[model samples]
Target chain A: MSRRGLLIILSSPSGAGKSTLAGRLRQWDDTLQFSVSATTRAPRPGEVNGQDYYFSSVADFQDQVAAGDMLEHARVFENYYGSPKGPVKTAIESGRDVLFDIDWQGAQQIKNSDLQEHVLSIFILPPSIKELHRRLVSRGQDAPEVIEKRMQKSWDEISHWDGYDYVLVNDDLDTTEDRLKTIIAAERLRRPQQPHLVDHVRKLQSEFGDRP
Target chain B: MSRRGLLIILSSPSGAGKSTLAGRLRQWDDTLQFSVSATTRAPRPGEVNGQDYYFSSVADFQDQVAAGDMLEHARVFENYYGSPKGPVKTAIESGRDVLFDIDWQGAQQIKNSDLQEHVLSIFILPPSIKELHRRLVSRGQDAPEVIEKRMQKSWDEISHWDGYDYVLVNDDLDTTEDRLKTIIAAERLRRPQQPHLVDHVRKLQSEFGDRP
Candidate 1:
């Protein structure tokens, strides 16, 4: 009996280690499929076409949106980004878990979709704002003003923490990773996810003298 | 800054290995307190007071029930049985998870109580009714008629499987135990169970310049 895969959503603010944890989870379980999002933005240097982002023209991305092929989509700074429904559906039906690194809005859209029951959303929080600021500055990618802007946006993201099924205070990396793995393992056993249980329970009923 | 304990309700049909699994869980984590039920029935030979069951008089049991000290209670064969509220309240308030080996009816009562959010109910299912019957026969303690009656009642217990927060098909003891432990570990991390999260989030707020 093949089990249906989980749609794992990992969301966090800018410096909360969501990407790092997602990477570690994938490395821990090679079978997990990382959702490749479709985006209208041009690929950055060294970014592979299909791997980093499913590079799409604005019209193509909008076509996907109009066709209802996008599970969740958002407009960021005049560029469109969205999760493609096809790969996620295929992976889960084949019993492979799909991991999504998206924000709260995207998480909500996924949760409200037809595959709502399959979604397992987790929100990661930095230990403290001081730690968050420290990490953002340490990244060296954004300027101080840009860091300040991101710090302001952090609160908005943190406010949505309660909406997730599980929340992790990312104080320690290893511990958080272990907790995430435990959540995924337990969720996989949920009755709705294991459709084969119908046949299993039917067999048990027959053995109990329900049938001659 | 203390966390509240979980009210873990484990229910299973006879021969589903509920008691064996409960014992193994306690052995694995000594900190988990096993709930000792109060009963008006006379102690069986070798049953210890306060250990096996809190042997109580009918009047005393009625008094406790009137005082709102019984979390859940029921009448069985001209005797009263119940879970005492005092010890469970103290244990959970002091951050000790309490395990209850009660049926679906009791599980429903506890879930509908004030501590509903703290409750974690799990139902165990045997791999097959044939296996269940084999295990009951192997015990060699019950008469064939009693075993047959228990077999008849198994479906009644199994029917309530959907009422629980989690359900495990006990196909293998070791695997089932591992899954149970994982569920507990993840549950402990739930935000409502961790009161210290209030202070943690406050600290984060101050660090974000929300406080002077």
Candidate 2:
């Protein structure tokens, strides 16, 4: 029988190269799934209706929250965003690990959920505040005021970094990417992630019993 | 600040290829130390004094045990065997990972020791009991009764496989060797294993503080 899958939560502040790393991880293992979050925020330009997010009405988002459909949710500014529990549960139960690209707040929620035992959370840190600011400003030509606001928000996320099982500084993209792959590959070998081992051992035991 | 090292514990039955795998692991990384256990048993053929086993007198072994120099000790049939606590404490504190090739009892004792937090235990299972028997018999032209006794002792060890953090079936030497390397590489990336990360983050914090 297939073992249960890991939550594989990846948390980082904005512009920490988490998105690029996540993309690389998926390419390395196509079986790895991205947990598409549902949000009440209007889609940004060039964003697909369902691919970027499962856009939902404010009322529907709240309804799912009330019905316990969201694995974790948060109100960020004017929008409501969350991971729906059904797809994640289905994917994990079938032994397909689901990757969550989320902030610490959502991470804490899922860690406290019933499926907490299956969660493997990691936090990524920027090499330095200077580098973080560089990436933030490099993204788009935002006004100085907007950039300042984003900087404070990024710091807010970085301050909560100590809550993860593994933390890596995104010093070099290639090094960080390779390290992430190593972490994932090793985690898959953990005892809880390989239930079929029990059967293998049982077969050996029987084989021993039948010996001369 | 350098992080503390792990006590990499590897346990398996007599003929499960644990020795070969351990040899390959040491070859893969010379810095990985083999924890030379002190035993009161007589030196076997072709075994070196310090490299193979630290052959000790029974009185000396018991004295070390009484003085608490032994990390974990156990008696098998007639002889006492144990891991010395001194070298391990020094190696780990100095950030050099130590490898322990001991039985389940010693593994459990170390897991319960003060340095339990630094322990990373793994168990190797043979692909089949028939193969295990084949390996045991193939070693020498022993009497059937001696082989039978060995088989029972091997089963005794195999029964405790579930206590390990990671368990692998030794179906192929190269595959198991690679997997062992992967486990070690990933474990090194764990949060607790990287104390210098704290300092790095503090530097980043100061970098942010200096910003306008």
Candidate 3:
């Protein structure tokens, strides 16, 4: 009796090293399936269309949301982004854990969904605002104005850090990554996650009864 | 803002290797305080008065139970066993995790305690009934009738395994010990366990506000 998979949601402000940590987690366990969100926003350079995100038209995104094909969707300023329900449903039903690297809003939406019981949400915090700003600037990916806007968005995300199962401060990448692995490994041993324990106990019961 | 410590409750049927695993956990983290139980039963040879069990007379045990000194207690066969509340309260208040090697009834009582949010309960299951019997018989601690009686009690204890937060089948001692350590380590990273994280984020918030 195999159980349904967990939805491992990782949320962090920009420059908090969450994306890098998520990548490390996937490398640690290749069984983890990354959830690629569908977005109306244009992909940046080097961003693969289907791999990075399911690039979509606003009309197509709205249609999917209306058709109940989106598990959770939100309008982030000018663009619509959402987790498509189809792939996630298929992954979890087949007993493969789905990893979600989303913001606080997406995490909240997924936590409020019908499959909320299977959700394991974690929030990552950067060491300091100065460090966060430094990392964002060091990325060399955005202009000063864009980085400023992201800094404000980072604060908004960090404000909701209280609403998570586990919260880790990214003071050290190696330590934080190890803790993430430990959390995932331990979560797998929980009673609700291992349905085969039922059969094991039943076998023990029969063996107990058979001892004459 | 240091948080109050967790109450780690470990339960298992006899001969399930819970004791050895618990010993290993204490060795794994010396900060873990073992909540020694006071019992009305007389001490066996080599069992320390305070370290192993706080052997008390029936009247003394009942008095403690009535005086609200006992956190949780129950009569097993002819003897009363209970966890004293004084040391556990002090330990947790000072920010030290306390470990309880107890049965399911005691685990249930602690879960209903006011400190329920801090409770991390785990149950260990033996690999097989035949293996459980072999372990019991190999111990050579009792007569055949006593062994038979304990076998029945083991079954009763295993029946309540569904209530624990995590359940592990003790097929291999080292693996089970490692899993127990992982569970404890991961639980420490939970949001409620680290109240100091509040201070951390507040500092970050100030840092954010100070940025021109």
Candidate 4:
């Protein structure tokens, strides 16, 4: 029988290299997969249906919520977005680790649910707030006022660092990426992942295996 | 204020490439230091006095055990060996991560003591029992019978793998080393390790910091 997969939840503030590290982790290991979240928000022009996200109507999302199909759902910027419990459960049961690149709030919601033990949490922090603001402005995705709002949001997000099982400081992308890969490998070897090995080894004794 | 360094306890079977990984970890990060254990066993001719193991007398070891100066102590192969609590306390207080290349039993003793919260436990496993036996025999220092005995001991040692907080499978040496390094980096960014940064960032509020 194939062993089950682990659930890894990674949370980070804006500009903390969460997406970058998550991408590298998936690339480094084929057994690891990403959980595509479902969203009620309309997808932009270039977004693919399943590749980008599982797009659904507001009504469909509400139905999933009411039926307990959504693992963790939230309303953001006047639109609802959530992680579909079905795909994640299927992936893990079939021996593929699912990576969740969600925020601290979403991670907490998932942790509070029945899937808590399956989730391995990691929080990322920039080396300093000064560096965080610098990176956010460097991206140039937002105006000065919006950047200020993001900076404020970062503080509140960073305060939840202690809630995580592991924390990574994004001082350099290369080093941080390397660390993320290692964490995945280590967590994969957890005892629960290799239950059959113990019995398999013991059975070798009955087969007259080579020994002293 | 300086951050407190974490005490990392690594336990694994003898030929699981743990020492190689631990050595590479120390080379990659200067902030990490090794905890030289004290032992009553006679040092080999080529073994350096303080550099290899702190050569202590049976009486000296028992005295420390009675005085409660050792973090963890035990007798192995008719010789007393232990880790002193004082040096570990001083090193961690000075912001240096101390590594304990110990067995699971010693790690358990440390875990039970007051150092439980600060301790990060990692257990290493070889990819397979066949691979482990190959590595052990390849060393060529032991006879066939001796290698078999060591393999049996390795099985006993690995049976307690679940006691660790993290588990690393040494399938690839370089990858395993990288994984261990990342685990250390992630632990260093934990909230308890960054207390000074809390108020330090608050000072940057006037520059652009606003709490959401």
Candidate 5:
């Protein structure tokens, strides 16, 4: 039997490198699937409907939520966004690991759901707040006031770091990516994930002597 | 601050190749310390004191046990053998991982002790009982009856495989060793194992704006 896939949840403060690490992991293992979240918001100019987000009507999103189609959902600035249970179930059942690039609240909801045992949550930390601020400034997209607002929100995100199963400090991008891959490889070998062991053990039992 | 070392307990039945893997791990990382057990049995002519075993009188062994200096101890056919707490404590505090080659019973005792949080237990399984038997027969030093007795005990060992934190099938020695190293590397990054992270977070807090 094929091993069941893990639901990998990666969360971090805005300047931390979770998105970069997630992208690297996908590049490393092409078979892994990235979760496409359903959202009520309008698609951006360059965004594809199903590939970027499962763009949906507000009524349709609510209906799916009520029908238990969402693994986890949240309202953000009058827009509903969620991870659909159907696609994740199909992916994992077919032995494809799904990656989630959601925040801590979404991670918590999925962890508390029925699929808690399959979740592997990781939190990435910026090496220092000075570095975090420097990175935000280097982006050059945000004004000074906006950068300060983001700095405030970063701590709010970092406060929930303890809730994760594994924590990584993204001081060096390559090293952090390597560590994340190692974590995924090890989690795949967990006993409950490998049901084929039952048959292997049964074969061993048949080979035992009758003297016992 | 130095990270505390993990107490790695590797358990496997006879012919499962745990010993060979353990030796390879030590060779792969020379910093890892092998746990030398204490015993009440008389030392052999070639045995070096403290290097081979901390040879002790039965009364001395009992005294150490009563004093809570033994991490896990057992009596087998009137001889006492145990993991001493002192060496392991010193090694871990100084940032040296210790390897324990013990049975399931010893593993259980160490896992239940005060140092439970520091322990990482792995159980190795042979790919098949036929393969395990073949490995034993190929050794050529053991008589047929002795090999049969070991085969009986192998089943008993395999029964407790679920109790380990990680399980690996010894299908390929190199692959199993690589997986073991990966598990250890990821485990070292766990938040509780890295106390210096507290200082890192505190620095972040100091740099935060008073906007909250």
Candidate 6:
């Protein structure tokens, strides 16, 4: 019998390199399926319906919340967003590990939900705050002021590190990615994840009686 | 301020490919150190001193036992074997992850010892018993009768799968090995493992004064 897939929640500060590692992990492991969150915010240019996010109206987002269909929902800055329980549950039941690349608030909400036990939480941090600031500025994505704001926000994000089951420091990109890959592989091998394979091993043993 | 290293225990039946994986992991990450077990058993041919096993004497072994110097020890099939407490403590204190390649019994003993808090148990299994049997027979070291005995022994080993905190099936050696590498890397990044790194990150924000 196939077991449900693992729910992997990965959280990291803006410059901690989790997004890159998560992307590489998905590229490396075919079994992993990314969790697409639905948000009330308007899609930016080049954002696809299913690729970037599932765009929803404010009322629709609230409706999912009231209907208890969203696994975790929150209002961030103005817009409401949530992980739809349907797609996540379906993917998991089909034997694909679903990855939730989200923040602490979202992860905490998921943890409080029924899906908490299935969740494997990981929080990633940069090796140092100097490194975090350097990486953020080097990216050239944000103005110095905006980058400074993100640095401030990182502490608030990282403060919830203990709430996660695993933590990672983005020391070097390649090594950090490699480490993420190992955690996923090891978790998949966890006994709860492979009962069928264990039974298969037993059946094979029974076939070969000790031939002394 | 260095954080503590994670104590990872990997238990698997013979020929399940843990030794190779452990070696590769250490090769990939300089920070990971393997726990060299101390034993009273005579070293086999080609075994180097302090490499394959820390060769010790019966008298010294007894002294250690009396002093409770071992994290775990046992008399197995006519030999006394134990994991020494001193070096492991030092390695962990120095901020290096230690891998324990032992059987379930040794893992249990280590868990029962003071190292339980740091221990992360992982059990590896072959994808199928048929595959495991094939691997055992191909080695050709065991006679046909001995192969049968080992296959039988594998059944007993498989029974303890539940005792592990994580399980991995060695279905594809390369893939599984890569997976294990991630597991170790991720566990090392745990929050408790990097308290100093947290402080280091915070210190940068204070130095930059919201500018950098």
Top candidate (TM-score): 5
- Better candidate number, 2 or 3, judged by TM-score: 2
Off by over 4 Å in 6: A1-6, A13-34, A38-68, A75-80, A112-118, A126-152, A165-196, A208-212, B1-8, B15-68, B75-80, B95-97, B112-120, B126-152, B165-196, B208-212
- Cα lDDT computed for each candidate against the true fold: 0.89, 0.91, 0.91, 0.80, 0.88, 0.79
Which pairs of residues collide in candidate 6?
Answer: A129-B201, A167-B189, A182-B182, A182-B183, A183-B182, A183-B183, A189-B167, A190-B167
* Interface RMSD over true interface Cα atoms for each candidate: 1.8, 1.3, 1.1, 4.8, 1.9, 4.1
Q: C-alpha displacement of B62 in model 5, angstroms?
A: 3.5
DockQ, structure candidate 3 = 0.74
| Candidate order by decreasing DockQ | 3, 2, 5, 1, 6, 4
DockQ, all candidates in order: 0.53, 0.70, 0.74, 0.25, 0.57, 0.38
User: What are the per-residue Cα lDDT tens digits for candidate 6 across A14-85?
Assistant: 888877888888789877888988999999999998778899998888888999899888888998878999
Cα lDDT over the full model 4? 0.80
Off by over 4 Å in 5: A42-47, A56-69, A209-212, B140-143, B209-212
Docking class of 1: medium
Give the share of true interchain contacts found in each model.
0.57, 0.81, 0.86, 0.31, 0.67, 0.67
| TM-score of candidate 3 to 2 decimals | 0.88
Give the residue spans of candidate 3 off by over 4 A: A1-4, A40-50, A55-69, A140-145, B1-4, B40-50, B54-69, B76-79, B141-145
Q: What's the TM-score of every candidate structure?
A: 0.89, 0.89, 0.88, 0.70, 0.90, 0.69
Give per-residue CA lDDT, model 2, range B1-212, as digits (tens).
46778899999999999999999998998888989889999999999987888999999999999998899999989999899998898888888889999899999999998888789999999999999999999999999999999999999999999999899999999999999999998888888888888898899788888998
TM (B chain), model 4: 0.88
lDDT of 4 by residue, A1-212 (tens): 34667779989888888888887787788778888899988899999988799999999999999998888989999999899999888987787889888888889888887767677788887877777888899997788899988887887888787788767777789987876766665666555655554564455343315543
- Highest DockQ against the true fold, candidate: 3
Model 2: what is its DockQ? 0.70
Root-mean-square deviation of Cα positions for candidate 1 versus the true structure, in angstroms: 2.8
In model 1 chain B, which range of ten residues has the least summed lDDT? B203-212
Off by over 4 Å in 4: A1-8, A15-34, A39-68, A75-80, A93-97, A117-120, A124-152, A166-212, B1-6, B15-33, B39-68, B75-80, B126-152, B166-212
Better of 2 and 4 by DockQ: 2
Please give the TM-score that candidate 5 achieves against the real structure.
0.90
